[model samples]
Target: MAGKLNILFITADQWRGECLSALGHEMVKTPHLDALAADGVLFKRHYANAVPCGPSRASLHTGMYLQNHRSGTNGTPLDARHTNWAKEAAKLGYDPVLFGYTDTSQDPREEDPESPWLLTYEGPLPGIRPVAMMGTWPTPWTDWLKANGYEVPADIRYAYGERAPGPEYEDGAAVPRPLIYPKEADDTSFLTDRVIDYIAESDKPFIAHLSILRPHPPFVAAEPFNAMYDPEAVPGFKRKTTHDEEAAQHPWLEHQLGRKLFRAPAVEKKLRRMKAVYYGLMSEVDEALGKVFAFLKESGRWDDTLIVFTSDHGEQMGDHWLLGKCGYFDASYRIPLIVRDPRKEADTARGTEIDLFTENVDIMPTMLDLIGAEIPVQCDGASLRPFLEGRAPATWRREAHWEYDFRDPADDSAEKRLNLTLHQCTMNIIRDEKFKYVHFTKLPPLLFDLEKDPDEFTNVANDPAYLPVVLDYAQRLLSWRMNHDEQTLTHISLTEDGPVTRRAARY
Candidate 1:
């Protein structure tokens, strides 16, 4: 803690919180991440505040809730006035380099009308330096593939799915086919290589954001990883017996199931195969991370670095008959969070798993606090420094909160389908130890007694017995919102003598 801490912030896309081997998961294997957790404090109940990449990363970077940031959807622009961790870190003499994507949609008011960044939501964060940019197109990885004598696809987006020359399935069941590129040439490997090279070459204390794209899409793994997990052995989903039965729980669930993009494959084998490959991709990323961890240790920078490993959001992975990250299920919002603080003060808490409720908004404050920077007043989350030092705050949050906005501005698809206006196409979740209450802006509410039905199969919102519980949780959600509403300038006022100000106490 004497000198500035070097920060290695990593995120694997669409990873489930329960998939880590250290968590005693039955199917997936994440040995490298497990090792990191063994040396760090693992947060068992951490969650993302929003769904999809743009809004969730907005919350993660700015330390604000979705309601405060207002970057509701994938293409929604983040307000340019807001200060992010990257910008704050830069003020303290850190370069704040990015090795992969942030999924930020640049504010149009700050850009030219002819700018190409305006067309894509994959714009870099305002203050960060994107050294190896890999967004939706992934030109850097694809270019590496072509340079290595591998045939690149005509459309670069299909690079991840370019399969090797072989039949896709064994017998009649679907199997995850291997991609043409080897594990060394994979996107995850490319990002890892970039991070290692940058860290090795940097002379100053480095701050690098390694955002890896894996376990996210295309669901295909390279060579050995594709065959790592057996489709038959993977665990069954947490959904009801049939899709229709799952849809009957709520109208929002029904609408999501009706969409082809979110619906799980009808074929049982196909769904199982995708799940297997998803696990495989996670292991592959873990392997790539092993190299980075080893490099840090071997270079003698391990003890001075503060490593934060997490995901922007969680993947449903066919839970509740859905395949993507959205809706009210815990599978879509809950994500893994491991913080390895290589200081003597953190030794007592190493390998300890804390069950306190944490959210993506807390990430920014944690990083800012560790680096000796003043956390912005706009941050809705409290820092995890106390937890890292083996002490819990006197008063901590008992529940996790998240929001999902399904508005499609370009087409208004959700609005037309759900009979809601753009502002009404939103849902907020309040989940505690034994119950979860989902409040939609204009739609019906959903309450689940988690202790009785852990899988969230039944809705008790309208059951007369649970009406009081529903009202209580609704009030709690409103109180939480009102308390955490944007406070950037609310604490400042002009007095007759001078301007008076008070800092917002995050905890």
Candidate 2:
């Protein structure tokens, strides 16, 4: 509480909120993250505000909702005027460093038409310095792999899928094999090494973002981790018996299921195998993080550091007959959140599980708050400092909110398929203790009674009995949006004398 606190912000890609062993997950064992939660406070109902990587991170880094940020898709550019946590921290004299990618799409207004950064959405956040950046290309990791005498692939994207020398089938069935690279040379390990090296050499208090890409795509794990969990032992999918039955839920669900990319494999054994590999990848990441946590304690930085462990978004993992992060389901938005404030004031809250609704937008304000930086007026979320100090805020949100835009500007695929305009290819969700309402721009709305049908297998919006509940939630969602619209200059007024301005209250 006295000196500048070191910040270690860690994000694992495509991690489900319920997969942690600390939360009683049946199969996945994330011992290192569970230990971090023991020293931190874990929010049970935390959610990402948007889907995929870029849009979710835009909300995460800027503390603004997707509606305010307007970065709806992966390739959508983030507005240049927004002030992010990195920029706010930089103002307070802390050099924010990134060990991996932020998945930021640079605002086109700030770049030339031919600029290479404009070509991809996987750009770095504006204020952070990249120590070892990993993205779609992952040049740094690939270069390291090549330098270490490993046979690099002709196409770098295939690096992670490269399997060890072995038969492709076992007992007349296809199985996931370990990667050709050893565990020490894996991408997760490389990023962890960079973070450890940076912390070892830094002389002053540091702010480092360690973004680990795992439990994501190319789901194969290395060596021992590949066999860590038995495929049959993993929990079964939470979905209807057949894809056709699941797709009947809604028009959007039907559209998503029709696409091969989003649909789960038709083969049941393959789907189970993929789920097992995903858990294996999670275990590998957990082990890598164990090293970082150990190094922090050994280097005497553990007590002085504030660590936040989370994910950009959640993975569907064959849930509801889907394989990727998209749509309006909780499986795509609800993610893990664990905040470990090193100050003595936070000790009382350690190991506590908060059931409150927290979103990815809260991350920016929380980091800024811990560092004593000004939370920008553009931020739509409140700081979690009060919770960290063992007290709940007077007014806390009871519901979680998220938005998804299915529009494809390049090909107009969603527009053409859904028979709607680009703007109509979007949906917003408001979910609380008992009910969830999904409002689409043009499609039919979906309302689920979470208590009666927690799996969201049925929609009750059309039922006369639930019509009032839908109306109430719709009004609440509208009010929530109206209240959070961009406020950067809304607090300032032009006067005859001089400008009079008031700071925006986060809550």
Candidate 3:
């Protein structure tokens, strides 16, 4: 509303929406993010439209659903034809820098089939300039460590956790120990330092996407962070007492609960320890981010920067006997979103909390709208510019919709085990304030009364008393799908004068 604003988009991988201290979480403390919310507006009900980094970031970057983008799995490539925020920002003469991994699978059609990029899902997104890129291997950070006299492990994952010297568990899940690296050398710290250094060198209005991987796997924290919380004092999990109890609820849950990698720790104490470490990791990230906030303010860029903080998706962290982000659970999809616009016009809405059902797709459009850039017609999300300007849109969504395409194209392990076709391995969820409805491609549907059972321990889909609610939600899901189906070419037509395009003129 005043000057050309610099965009700082930060994402924390696998961070749950409820973990923010500003949002009144009991255990975790995020003082920096709390300060951010105090200076900005927070969307309390933002959800990711897809899961497992690749599919979710595909929607986040392209502003399209999994159905429209078709990048269903981690190794799946995003179609090259689609336009992304990075490409659009590049059109406006910005480099659109990326400080961390985007989890984008390279489009095979544009490269050699044997190209190294095709081998992993950690490839950089199409148009962004990589100021620094850290992935599962994290060559950049590892190299930095090596240069600084730190021993680099062949498998970088070992640096995150230690396995006990004793015999492993029956399921082969090793005991997770605290990180071997120092607090300053942690991944979150390294990335934040890199971003601060990059911002220092830039004089132009820039768009930087910082993707942080913390409070995510390995369940390890460094130094005081590892000792920040007591495992015994951690909040209790909102899951069934045992895995079998969860599995008995649905066929999908049974299959999901059987996966060793996603299963919660068998020992209750060990599970609570994992949760304590997770909260510590979150606290570490918050501390690391505090440096960024300090840098922005010290450099006098705070007033001209639009800061956005959110996660790609959320982790279950023992919720429903699950550890990773997947299935139809709210813990897997709900993510925190905070936007701080420092323009004088946005002062009225600063420190405000908007209670609207928002999704990851809305992010791209919101950025474009703020920068006065043209929003692509292909985006399924609407901009939140009105909210930042202290006005509600005439019409806003009342429900949050998310989809998880669970097909493993390489192994097809799920297909054979679950007796499902690759095409039938998907699930979609529609959740309103009061109720949530989960529909699988080829499995039994699930209905949860959020008001009565927030933990979602009970599925009331088959209850005669709730039949009307289920039917209504089912129809709403159908209507949502019909309304959001792909329309890339729908607005274009060949008229008597020539070809006419409704949205093409803006670009």
Which regions of candidate 2 are displaced past 4 Å?
Answer: 1-3, 168-175, 504-507
Candidate 2: residue 131 lDDT (0-100): 92
For all predictions, the C-alpha RMSD in Å is 1.4, 1.6, 3.1
Per-residue C-alpha lDDT of model 2 across residues 251-312, encoded as one tens digit per residue: 88998998989999878777887888999999999999999999999999999999999999
Ten contiguous residues minimizing lDDT sum, candidate 3: 167-176
What pairs collide in candidate 3? Answer: none
Best by lDDT: 1
Q: Write the per-residue lDDT of candidate 3 for residues 1-507, one digit (tens) a residue.
A: 232779999999999999999999998999999999999999999999999999999999999988899999899889999989999877777789898899999899998978999888899999998978888778788889889998877887565564324332233433335577788987889999999998899888889999998888778788778768887788988888788988989988888888898888788878877888889999999999999999999999999899999999998988898989898998999999999998898999989998989999999999988888888988999888888889988888889999988888776888887889999999889998899999888888999999999889999999999999999999999888888888888888999999988763211
lDDT of each: 0.91, 0.90, 0.88
Q: Which tens-of-lDDT digit does each residue in 396-419 have in candidate 1?
A: 898999999988878777788889
Clashing residue pairs in all predictions, respectively, total 0, 0, 0
- Candidates ranked by lDDT: 1, 2, 3
- Which stretches of model 1 miss by more than 4 angstroms? 1-3, 170-175
